[model samples]
Target: MSKKKGWVEQTDGYLNKTPTFQFILVTILFALWAIAASLNDILITQFKSVFQLSDFATAFVQSAFYGGYFLVAIPAALFIKKNSYKLAIIAGLTFFSLGCFLFFPASRLATYSVFLIAIFVIAIGLSFLETSADTYSSLLGPRRLATVRLNISQTFNAIGGIIGILLGKYLVFTDHNLQEEMARLSDAEAIKFGQQVLQRTLTPYIYVLIVLIVMIILFSVTKFPSGKVRKKSGEIDSAKFGETMNYLLHNKRYWRGVLAQFFYMGVQTGVWSFTMRLALDMFPHFNEKYVANFMLYSYICFFVGRFLASYLLSRFRETIVLTVYAVIGTVMLIGTTFIPNMIAIYLAVGVSLLLGPGWPTIYARTLETVDDKRHTETAGAIIVMAIVGGAVLPVIQGLISDATTMQFSFIATAVEFAWVAWYFISEIKYDIRSTVTNKSHSLED
Candidate 1:
């Protein structure tokens, strides 16, 4: 097999010998992170009931998870700089496994605070995995296939979603009268019941931790095409963190894209976490659980859309796709707000069709504005910023749901995408101006 060039790496070892295992292994690890993210919503009430946590308290699940992204992103960059991808990924696996195991004691003790701590540990691990794996995966011999690389990783992520939803639904809610029990339980009864309910989650996560431990161990001994980039490169020569950040600060467009990433992520996370609730709560006749289950199919929309963007952009100019999806996503948001039917709720979910195209597209477009000076950190930082959407948008939805009806909370949610639109508009303006300048210069020449 011929070797590929640039940020792509396609050594025969990873390809001809171990392609299936390599993809499966990486996909499983990424799936662990996704399960943690998506399952939190399905099991939020379980957390609440078990620990007597409030909606605000339960929101900490998101806070701790996303907060870790910000906390660990820069540090993970440094770690990736200091260590090989193997070591960083192993460390992430260790963090994730240990984090999952902590849930057992948290379950036994039934402490909300412990659960938060446990979840934070999981997030800490995931931040490293994301930072290392995304970069590592990108380098594994097909930069052109980055969208495919990421999509394959994310398809497992979607599989994890299906697993989490099924597991959460099965375990969290009791067979008996939960509403009545919730309404009239004495302290002793509640605590006892909470313990059993806690077991439902605790058991699976326990198994997950064990599996993660083995995955890490196996990965340690196994060799594949090493895609490790030399640590930090030229970007981190300075001793002071402040100096590096200042360098980033001086790059105006780099920072602009980062901030835009933050808002875009907040919106995406907000919409995804709440889509089920939005369907069930807003539409009276539909069953919440059923609606939530049906919403899993929504992943198909996302998966298809992303693949389409990848294929389409392979041929067409990215500027065209970026402008179309951004504008269409905005239109969908507006349409979602006006359409009151349950059928329209599913149609609103189709907004994700356009939504899936956004990530890889945005990353490629952002690269246009950035220099290669701090490529990994700049790219990872943007992704880190996007996680803020995960933390902030849910609270915004929860708050809005409290003030008004649940349906209109999406309106608040859609505003986050407003930034996505701005990015697209910026792309259009930049592309047009560049094109016009090129044409004018050609005329002059």
Candidate 2:
């Protein structure tokens, strides 16, 4: 085969000699990180009760976790550059497992700062996993199908999020009345009770550690495709860092996708953080567990939406689908803000459905605009770093809630969805202009 035709065939086949097992394995990594992030959300409430932490202190848990992502993303990409994706993933799993093990000591010491350190370590591991795995999964497929592939992989991510919530609900939160009970205790007694509660929080991490070890073992034994990039000059190595950054800086489509991704994370994390509170406020008769189920439902909707969106992307224009869903999500959040009674809460859950494709779609579209395939890993890392928006925007939502109302806070989320919609709308125009320009040249020829 000629080199041009050979490359075209390879880029056109979805799994093009990629092992099914390896692809499945990489897809599972999506779920693992989602579980970590959702578990972090659970930890916030758990720490507030067990550590007797003020809201500001509890907020540090997120700060440490997301800060780790921001700090580790570039390093993780560099690590993948120096080593193989397999090696980077194994290293990430090792960090994750080690961090989980540290929870044992953190629980034993009952020091919030120690636990924060442990969370940061886990986030570091997650940063590595996300940076490698997301890019790796896309590499496993046809270039044209990358968006659908990522959306399918992220479906498992949504599932993992649900699993994390379930773990928190059943394992970590055995005593719903623990907070009330703590209020009744003497200072020393409360100290002892808090320590015991902290000890119980260690259980879920132990389970995660066990899973990570199994994953490590599997990855170590598997043989994977090289997954190297092919430059126009037929080189296997990636572009240099300076060249990559210069290209990225000039790639307006790429930076716009990154901005859209940032807003999407902000919308998602902000909505999840307040879902339960919104439920409780709207339905005063409901208990915590009862309202908490709405969050579970929201996660399920998100999971289901991903699968549905993946199918849609396979059948329709990705930008069109993304634009439609985001616009619908924006409308739903606006309704969530102004609608009264139970309907508003339902609208909030429904928004999760519309947002199902936001992250993966944004990621795939951004990577598509990278002219040099070698830059994919670094580009992926920068997008992963955008997750810091998750840490920042919820705080914005919280402040809005405090100043105005919880319902009013969703207006901010609506604006975020609007931004995503606007992004794709602009992309659609770009696509049209490019098509017209190409057709004009063809007619002249």
Candidate 3:
């Protein structure tokens, strides 16, 4: 009988000389942000019901959250360059905890705009965490296997997403017919009920806030690997934003990645934001709490997909695996849009399975475009900024849903995945040509 290999064997030395403990510590940061982001989906339905918002208006939940990622990513990168990834992680956790703490007051105020403010603050912190953690994870292993390593880390992120949706399903979503109840109540009674829903929303954040505090303390004490060791403070060249931006602009591959990430983020956010809406629309008998069960299942598929993608990435070409996922995702989303049946909605939920490998794969590939290691931090920041698509694309979907049916709105996500498929196809073509050219040159030699 053959002996079974462990995870280290499976990685094929991708983890060679990697700082195991530091990687574990930094990987936790992935889950931290994912929990916050996934909870936003629950918030969208809760806020829409409590505040009586249109689909378009309710999407501002994503807009405010990802908008902070857009604005803060560059500054967070600069901070990491001047300071350290470890410090940036701590700063992010602090900001996150602060934002989570604000949920108490936001709940008390029971104002949509105020809650958006708290969510934006949380996004600010997440921007810091993402800017630091993703780049940090890529650097933890061999450059070639960066995607695989990041995917391994992202598995925890999937777990966090699952936990978040579960928390929202149980703690936030109410079983009662909120619309009918609100319609029947007097103004004072409605306000009281709104406050109660807001209180339920605030409970999850409190648990998250406690976890963030613990993480901050743990990160402070742990020793993290330094990407670039500097003996003198003067060796830190933090003023290279202009140079880095110029370099990034000229890199075609990196821009392709940026576009892919943009669409992917948008579709990912929009799909989850409206999943509950779609569930309720398709099956009128389903309550918000029951619809949330589909979200839970969606995240579970995502969790499994991450683990599966990571394994496949280790065994196969990253471009090949990603291309397959993108293609499948595009087709599934198309089915989700046009097919008017239970299967159509199931396709939407199944999209999460394809989504698991996207962000990390694009991220690792984009960073590979930068030949100079010095620009990695800045380049990583700009890529993180592409997450703003989460802010923009969801609103576009929302507008479409409001104008058409919820089923038709998913056309936008289908288009987004089509772009990802094209990007990965181009990657495969480039790799093939490069391989052919190198082999021919070797024969001549």
Candidate 4:
């Protein structure tokens, strides 16, 4: 009992040390990204109907968004390395606001391609925000508290996701009668109605754009703690792409974490992308609004799970907790796959609880292993690049769903979680405590 109290005190000490305002700002940034990301699920459903697309085609929404993450990661890393995290954040907001505003043109044009372009641009902004915000949050306090800080921030992120889904459900998702009416119209009339439907989708984004603009102004004027490049003997050694690539390739643990992250992201994005589909499949009478609410519930579970995991992480080793969660997630996915009823739906929702801690835990764990602060930015970029898995796996799942059934497509998610569990088990010997001790020693020396 005393030992548990000591653990809580230690974690609280670290939390107390973090600058209150900075933490709040960073948490809000985390929430902003979540709001943007969750909106994609709504887009997938709406675009499918709006553009008359197939499952495989609807999957392109993820492709375009995460593809932007893949493409912009390195550049975002370079920008942060050359500048500061504050600048990177502002630049990210610039792109984010611009992308939101672009929805205006996309809506006016009423072209799916243009909407994809807007989403891609927004993703570019998000890539910068994610890389910078993640690193900044991790570095805000004691290295040991990195994952906890990120999880706390991500709790707000889940809240943002809930808000996004709700907004999309109420504002963006058209009424069933409207959809039915559009179906009955002549070809030209249907196109006009579709254009009107697409234009309505722009409203939420406009509101988002306004909020982003306000954030940009606030960020520009407020002073942020310097996240400068760490130096050895007051000399800055610029990271070379080739050398960094070689080093990362040679590090077995590093690459393995990368792979685990890839599969984890794939499963996460794939599952959320298809949650509504799976729900509809199980209950054919249900509407989009019902599925959206379910998605909101899943994120609520996600929010609560993050806090729960953060508590567990305080008491246990991160890798052990991660391994346990991964295994549980896999079991849940298996139940979701084999069980075909309302029970399967509940099991699928349970997967969110298990998934809540995996991403931040893996990220903080992987970054702990890296010895050089110089490499941290590049390392972050590589991890962000792995988000392309969100693009690749979901599309594959979509194709599989098109070929088979939605329940069967979840096999991909199950397999991915199995890999994550295996990763934690295989790398159990490389514990974070040792890495933190080494870092402390190096700093003292």
TM-score of each: 0.82, 0.89, 0.92, 0.90
lDDT of each: 0.65, 0.80, 0.85, 0.82
lDDT of 4 by residue, 75-188 (tens): 998898787788999999999998898899999898999999999999999999998898888666665667677878878888998888988999887546343466789999
| Best TM-score among the predictions, by candidate number | 3
Give the winner by lDDT: 3
TM-score of 1: 0.82
Better of 2 and 4 by lDDT: 4
Better of 1 and 4 by lDDT: 4
Point out the worst 10-residue segment of candidate 2 by lDDT: 1-10
lDDT of 4 at 278: 88
lDDT of 3: 0.85
Better of 2 and 3 by TM-score: 3
Q: How many residue pairs clash in each candidate?
A: 5, 0, 0, 0
Tell me how far the alpha carbon of residue 15 in candidate 3 is from the true structure, in angstroms, after superposition: 9.9
Q: Give candidate 3 misplaced runs (Cα > 4 Å).
A: 1-16, 142-144, 229-239, 437-445
> Which window of ten consecutive residues has the lowest lDDT sum in model 3?
1-10
Q: 1 or 3: which has the higher TM-score? A: 3
Kindly report which residue stretches of model 1 are placed more than 4 angstroms away from their true locations once superposed.
Answer: 1-24, 48-57, 142-148, 171-181, 184-188, 224-243, 283-291, 334-341, 373-375, 429-445
- Tell me the tens digit of each residue's lDDT in model 2 across 1-445: 1132123324222344345688799999999988887777677766766777654455567777877888899999988888788998998999999889999899989999999999999989989999988888877756655655666688899999898878877777653555667888999999998898888778778788899999999999987655666544544557787888998999988999888888898898878767766765566555445555677788899988887887887787778998999999999999999988788999998888887888887887787788777787899899989888777777777677767877888898999889989999988976687679989999999
Ranking by TM-score: 3, 4, 2, 1
CA lDDT for candidate 1: 0.65
lDDT tens readout by residue for model 1, 278-304: 665565455435555544666667667
